[model samples]
Target chain A: NAGVTQTPKFRILKIGQSMTLQCTQDMNHNYMYWYRQDPGMGLKLIYYSVGAGITDKGEVPNGYNVSRSTTEDFPLRLELAAPSQTSVYFCASSYKSGRSSYNEQFFGPGTRLTVL
Target chain B: AQTVTQSQPEMSVQEAETVTLSCTYDTSESDYYLFWYKQPPSRQMILVIRQEAYKQQNATENRFSVNFQKAAKSFSLKISDSQLGDAAMYFCAYYGKGGATNKLIFGTGTLLAVQP
Candidate 1:
């Protein structure tokens, strides 16, 4: 099913520069999320969308923004990229609604970003 | 706030041996979900196993299994017959279904190395 896909597998950005990481899922899931994993650390949530046109901030929402116009696509925007923002970014989707749905999230290959 | 913690920063095991990676989480919600995600060098977040807090029985998938202790707030992953392919960074995540964010909180991760 091709599952979830992320674009630009890797990227390099200069301080103060801006870029967008693309994410899409073939599964018709209602919940999507953006997370960043730093070296020697676990992932921290950046943003999440419960459904189309619905977005909310997660644990680490600073320096990033997200837009969910369609159920399949949710893009993360990095504004004024800094060295601290350099990390592996992952996009995940799950059918996390209702009490009976699945809570397991399917993740993308991930995008490694380096900000200098 | 809910938090996930992986006490071990790194672990090593020989091929065909068994290794257990420990994970503990702090959450007030009684009903929640837990997961173990493996991130190989390719950086794909692969779900290894899952455990629902409400289910007393442990969850197992082939060589991978989980020990879910609700009272202790602990979830550990046991890998039997460890293969080189099993080497990766394992992350423990907690999902509080009762929370408003409905997001997964991840531990720092344990870097697993399988020696052949």
Candidate 2:
């Protein structure tokens, strides 16, 4: 399986510019997530989706928006890129529901974005 | 909201030796999951090990294992037979049990350096 894949391995955006980070999973998982990792920091959840047509905000969803139209795709949109938004972005997917302690989330390679 | 913490910002170990990275989390929920993910220079989030809150037995995968202390809310990763390939940033994450939208909360991360 290709697992989870994210496009644009690296990108640079001017302040106030907008862009979409693409994520797709071939695992047919119902749960997907978006996270941003700053240098010297862990990761902060941006948005998550339980299934197609359903999405929810996460800990750091203020600057981003997400849409899950199909089971394989969940794209994150940065409305107004800021230097504060510059970080490594990751996409993940899990076959199990959120409440299952046995669930394992598979992650993508990550997209590094820089806002200037 | 749950929070994960990694007290050590950086650590070092000699090859063939053992190193432990400490992690603690705060959550009132009785059922949840924990994980340790390794990110090398390639920027890939690789799952090293996982633990269930209800399981008392520790989880091990080859050279990687975890010490999960439910009462103390502590989870630590031990890497035995450390190798240069093991040098990476390790992240501690938490997943609360049973929700339509299960999200993972991550700590600040620990950078491990394996010395030859």
RMSD of each: 1.4, 1.4
lDDT by residue (tens digit), candidate 1, A53-96 = 99999888999999999999999999899999999999999886
Candidate 2 lDDT over B23-99, as tens digits, reads 99999989888999999999889889989888999999999999999999999999999999999999999988864
Worst 10 residues of 1 chain A by lDDT: A95-104
Worst 10 residues of 2 chain B by lDDT: B95-104
| Model 2: lDDT of residue A31 | 89
Q: What are the per-model DockQ values?
A: 0.62, 0.73
Lowest summed lDDT across 10 adjacent residues in model 2 chain A is found at A96-105
Q: Clashes in model 1: which pairs?
A: none
Estimate the TM-score of every prediction.
0.95, 0.95
